[model samples]
Target: MENATPSRTALGVARMRALHQFSPQAGLFRDPYAIAILGEAAPAAQELEQEDERRQRMRLFVASRARFAEDWLAAAVLRGVRQLVVLGAGLDTFSLRNPYRDLSVFEVDHPATQAWKRKCIADSGLAEPAATRFVPVDFERQSLSAELAAAGLQSTAPAFFIWLGVVPYLTKEAILKTLSWIAGVPGSEVVFDYSEPAANRDAAGQAALAFHAARVASVGEPWISFFVPAELAISMGELGFDEIEDIESGDIAARFSEAPKGMTNNSGGGHIIRARRTA
Candidate 1:
């Protein structure tokens, strides 16, 4: 999150996605551009083959969340949603692989990260879809609503938002504010992931959380928010989201991925949720 520098965590997540490409279980959610998008930074086959339990769990979760979000998005498109806004889009290839020709995809991210993504895309020789619009806004300094509005996002129409790998990094107030904005769009839907408080986690989960927290903090992006599932669901309901699907960690792999043999689902307290504003 340092000024003028792309997020290190973003790059790390991208690497995980790249590693998943080499997974035999990739049929669950194939991202052909996942490795190519990273250009030279893509993980070597050796790295993919030698992944430990923790990294394997992380990789599957990342892929599962994307699968969950996109499955919901396909349903939204059928329901007449045209706008697809990717909040905190970090080297995500959804826009490139979009099957809905009419869907307008918006990639929203920090200016530094956005710039870096553009460079990577260009260097990788991947053609960005014409419908993909990049909106650069530093959430700390700029107004998301204002920036999206100026970038041709229709406020009057419903838009589907995919906010992944971002909620835990934001304060509760900021999270509510953003959700409130999404609620204002009639029939809007959003898919996002969040983690529960350490207290709610099992002993093994807490140990994993501590390690990951310290790692991210060392890179200057310490997680600042954790939500209890029921409380977060209530808050979303208050924001006008009538239908909510909360998928816990244990369920994610079963729901999305064809787990590799002996793959233990040790995803800790992470959860992926999809909320809809029907009214």
Candidate 2:
């Protein structure tokens, strides 16, 4: 993520999400604003037509992770949580499509990315929801806790955080620091995704991982962290989260029954996890 430019990987993720809208498995996760939010930047018909197995898998995984996170968020709302924080919110539309009238959404992201997203939203003629507040912070140079606090996050109230497409790019120390801050807020719950070590993946999976990793690295955002699921759960437990739900890449398709026929589970080491601080 360059200081003056939006993240390249962020743009790619948004494109994948937009492509998912045209997929047969669109029923797996319905994001009406996904395509609209991209404005002219949305993938062209040709791009959608040329999709391969890898692209299909990546598209579905991105959609499925959001579905899983929002499903948990709905459950949290039922349990009386009123605040929703989207960490590393790269063109995420949950804030725009928020169904809960009382839920306050805080979108935390890099300054440049947030600015670009704001412009995109305005250009697309989408109404910025009254519940949404944008918080800009450079993860490497600024403090998330401080930025979120300044943005009016209630430290005393429980908040549900959806951190997608972000964990693997951060160092272990940074990941734990953010989790620790979340843990300090009682009854808070968070959903995030992470990857296992490349060695844990099958040969084909390894190749795919390498390809994507190199692509992101070429843009200066290299993958720096990988966590073993069991170890991550243990770390979460120590950080004061009492409940943890970890889903592997291979199990995502099964969780969403409407997934298309060709969308088979990849043998990749990716995972999506939800951890709750119940104290």
Candidate 3:
């Protein structure tokens, strides 16, 4: 089946991730599928590659959080979690990484993104863990719960939901709908990121986001949401989450930065929250 076309930013982000992993200086993060996704399995080996400010910034921000997510996923498995869901999975190759061989992994993304990723997986002859599954969905035209149900998801099963770089693109109502659905799945904990209003207004941050958002909007995928971490916590509490732990973007940088201690980069926007539905 032809994957539903994803927004351009999805492609851009995928390519950016691919580029970063292909670079020699790109450290701490190891993503073998990243280069293959860009069809650049042999990106010329170099010392200190010239970097586009926007791409460099995105790579660093994405890289840091990718590390964080991997770390968290490991802990989740150790805690006896078996089901894992990555929303807007993009070119993220964690499923390919197979960090947990015993876990059932599911990737949810726009049909096009999933298609491109699948093709990359095939073209590169890279192994996709047979245990992992893919569900393609278009927010404009599909239902997440329905898609997952078709994939054999138990609505009441406890699961970890990784929602990176997606919440900001969804409408508030849609975000709430997803959370409510996740809550319905007993013991589900959601880990996702959302930006602050200041980041939206800051000059560099605004330009960076606008650059990506324009392409997203051009594809009829306008970002209908921007969430404040604090307000989001309150909203999630109201939505019935019994516990919520939030990590700010800056905090993520400080915690997992490979760029060196105190080598400040200000473009990281938003927070990743782990929320457990209590009610």
Candidate 4:
């Protein structure tokens, strides 16, 4: 997916979050910057519609999980975590709307995507936050630690990482390398989402996965890796995480607002996991 245009999936995700803003009241979470980040492409993004029922379900999951991650980050910040690192931060507006006064924010993504996002920010006439730093990185070609350090990230301090919309697009080895590295840092906690293996899915869920998987593959960033919830928990334990909270889609829906009509919050499709290293 290197040297490709900014991910279509990213644009779709941004659109989903932007739609949440229009929901009655504040919706799952408020992000006024979500639509602005689309810039001149806002109308084009709005015009891009999901023609299939399964695709619509997939879109709801995107917004739901984004809400989940942001809520968790807010709680983490309340506990005195002063740093936030966002991985694969495609069109994410958390940095722009960050409410914590003392928190430092970092946005990490592919160079090409980051460049496109910068242009979008400039076109929107929104000033980037002074505390927010962007680190252009290709995980396969460079070291995340080295890149973050070069960008002024403190390795010795506690930090919270928000990793969403990128795990399933990566390989098992790549995911492990990144997670293991995070575990090595003291007081590091990461909240990320991942798809469950097909064996765990029912017939309808499996069909939905097939449709969504094919759609992403067509865009060059296919779903390459998956995990069983049990196996994933064990893997995190082996990696030295002192605490692991595995939340499925159904749980997420119940914890948040009611699901809209025809919205299928299937846990078999994906999960949001938070792991923390206290030692």
Candidate 5:
């Protein structure tokens, strides 16, 4: 993953499309660029076509996550925070599907991924959101703050960053440094997801996480960090976020859970943390 190319961007989008196939009401998202953003070389897509059950689960995951990210962005904009940044942009469509009408949005990712995304959207005749800008940085070579500044970001602006399905791939130092950067900014907030620590692995847990780990490794990416939800809150506070909430994995699924018996853990899940900077 250190040396990436645009091809991986296409792969990322393909994963989303494969997963979205599970949602019976995907059209509700109305993100026209879904197919356009992901392109053709998706490993997940190929896997889904071969296995019906995998496809179904993928769709459910995507639908749930889409709901979370979209709702969070809408709320952030409603709250009057004008700047939104997406780290490890992957194939997320929030910039294209801006629920907030008047906010500045940045999509930051590796150069290969950013280029692939831009070209795909453009080739598909999908125009970027009028308020959107791209910020490409080599996570291995450049400092995130410096790269963002070059892309016209101001540290003083109260910003909201969305980082979904990304934390597990970042090192502990990298994650903490990034958080501290946001904390240094007088008033910034961010939402991201992290994997639970490996110590909690049960038979079910081990299998599920194993599949995920295998998938990432197949694509040259590795899971580098994990957090205990309780520890995550304390770490966030120490790094400068005043509030940290561990949103249950089933929180979003409960909103659309079909089982009257209620939600069950789906292998692994994320923490929907909305941390704010006060100092």
Candidate 6:
């Protein structure tokens, strides 16, 4: 990871997902094309599949959040949401697997990561879907609204956004600005994950947190923001989101109660939050 790129983490997530497909406890979600997209790099990625228990736990959470987000997207489409914006899209396969022919999937990510994903798609011999559009932007330097508009996103339409693996790395100001912007848009709902306030964690939790924190930081992306759930609820309410549902590990476990005995749910990790702007 010397020339570490954010896209590498995305690949890591994809590899984890590929491993999950073969797990005996697997069925929370399926991505038949994940391994295929990795192509030549897959054998090495597969080798790391059994590296450590902590990594396995991380993978489970990654896959679980993805499954949860995709489930919500499907539900949103049913409710007539025609636009899907994937912030920090990375290697997500939702666009390719999309069953809704009319749904417009906009993938917004850093230029380098977006380029890499496009190359992966090409190498896999999979043509990018006509309904899928890629919008490249530096999250800290560019305007999301401008980028999306340039990519043909309709501001007036109801949209569902999936923002995974990006929030904890962003500063609080950036997070609030993005949330406020999303709230300003009519009929928009976003699902993203955020870490709990580190100060609130127990000794054991703090140790686990330090381990993972060091790992990401070593790769040049550190977790800089966390939220207390109650405080986050207030923030969302103030920002104009009519509905907010923050799903914790316990809730995720209960939703997928059939998970295998070995599957680990790290309560110390982050939780997924869904916020909607109805008016």
lDDT ranking, high to low:
2, 1, 6, 4, 3, 5
Please, what are the lDDT tens digits per residue for candidate 4 over residues 219-270?
A: 7888999999899999999999989998877665567664554453573477
Clash statistics: count for each candidate: 0, 0, 0, 0, 3, 0
Question: What is the alpha-carbon RMSD of candidate 2 to the true structure?
Answer: 1.3
Give the TM-score of each candidate.
0.96, 0.96, 0.84, 0.92, 0.85, 0.93
- Between candidates 5 and 6, the one scoring higher on lDDT is 6
Per-residue lDDT over 26-126 for candidate 1, one digit per residue giving the tens place of the 0 to 100 score: 77678999899998899987787687777777787888899889999999999999999999998999998999989999999999999999989999998
Off by over 4 Å in 5: 2-4, 7-10, 18-22, 25-30, 39-59, 257-263
Which residue ranges in model 6 land beyond 4 Å of their true spot?
A: 1-6, 43-51, 261-266
RMSD of each: 1.4, 1.3, 3.2, 2.3, 3.1, 2.3
Global lDDT of model 4? 0.81
State the TM-score for model 1.
0.96
Ten contiguous residues minimizing lDDT sum, candidate 6: 1-10
- Per-candidate Cα lDDT values, in order, are 0.88, 0.88, 0.72, 0.81, 0.68, 0.82
In model 6, the clashing pairs are none
lDDT of 6 by residue, 1-279 (tens): 222254667776787787777765468778878778888765343455455766666777788899889988888989999999999988888888888989999999888888889999999999898999999888787999999999999988889999998888788988899899888878999999988876878775577688888978876777889988999999999999989999875466677865544544444556888999887
What's model 1's overall lDDT? 0.88
User: What is the per-residue lDDT of model 3 for residues 1-279, given as tens digits with 9 covering 90 to 100?
Assistant: 134554566666666666666654367577777766556633444512766655566666666667667777777778777899999987778887786767888899888878877887788887777988899987556899999889977677668888887887777878898898887787778888776664555686677677756766876766668876668878888878988888765564467545543325455465667888755
Candidate 2 lDDT: 0.88
lDDT of 3 at 132: 82
